[model samples]
Target: MHLYGCPMTRSTRVAWVLEEAGLDYHYTVIDLKSGEGFKPPFINLNPSGKVPALVDGDLILTESAAIGIYIADKVPAAGLIPAVGTSERALHDQWCFFASSELEQPLWLMAKHTFAFPPDQRCPAVLPSAEWEFKRQLKVLAQGLGDKTFILGEQFTVADVLLSHILTWATRGLKMDLGDEKLEAYRQRTQARPALAKAREREAHEAALKAQAQ
Candidate 1:
């Protein structure tokens, strides 16, 4: 298996999932800021020119959440997710979609206006609305996470892998205050997991590679 990744991209989510599954995969550093993502080879791997593209034999998977789900399903022994036909699995899908669509959507908007876009293209007026939307969605997420060790109760599923990272992105990337104590504790607990640590180790290595390329 080969994972084409870039530091601090959504690829970190796939790397975390792989660590939890104990999967041995080659990590290829693709420099997103250097315009390598738009070049032919990387573009062939993912037409969208995105990081976190996974290549396993003939199968090539793009999109960070899809890659997480694929890796979790691949290693059922890791128990990273519920069985395919179960109601719990349906909930897993629900949380994943909620995190991506509801929680992550505002963060993306904020990023686009904050720093991602070129200065001329950025819309400073959009930031306040984005912040308000993020806080509203965060409250919904906090309610969903009430009194649970993990998203599906006790077990740490891929849902947690996806959702926890989004929470981190909101708090760290967007610098939002996670107001609820439970939500803050949940982020700490999930981030302190050994698998996530291993993923960060790999990410540090990728960052070094990126630096060398520059």
Candidate 2:
């Protein structure tokens, strides 16, 4: 298996899943700065031209959420997901959509205004608005988390892998003032996971390799 990614990119999703599943896969660095990720070759692998594309032999997958679910299903022994038809599985799907639709959407807006767009084209006025919307969404998520150690009670499911990562980045980038203490503690717990720790280590190593070649 191989994952194409760059440090600080969406590729963190695949990297974290790989650790969670105890899978050793090859990491291919796609230099987004030099436009390597958007070219025909990488675009062929992921038509969306996004980072965090995964290739497991003939099964080539794009979209971080799809990749996360695929990995969890493939490694059921890892317990990243609940059994099919179970209530927990249903909840996983529910929260997955909530994370992508409710939480992540505003973060994308904030990112566009803050960095992806140029100073002139960027809409600074809308940034505060996006942050407000994201904060509102996070409050709902905090309530859903309740007193559970993970998204589905005490067990760590693949949903947490995706949602937690999104929340962590949103917190850092959106300056997410999680007014809710539950959400803040949840964020801290997910960020401190061993899987995330290992992925950061690998990302640092890959970054050093890129720097030395420059």
Tell me the TM-score of each prediction against the true structure. Answer: 0.96, 0.93
Pairs of residues clashing in candidate 1: none
Candidate 1: tens digits of C-alpha lDDT, residues 91-138: 999999998898888889989888878999999899899889988988
Task: Give the worst 10-residue stretch by lDDT in candidate 2.
Answer: 170-179
Candidate 2 on 2-51: residue-level lDDT in tens?
A: 98888887788779888989999988788887888789788899876779
Best by TM-score: 1
Name the TM-score of candidate 2: 0.93
- Which regions of candidate 1 deviate over 4 angstroms? 209-214
RMSD in angstroms, candidate 1?
Answer: 1.3
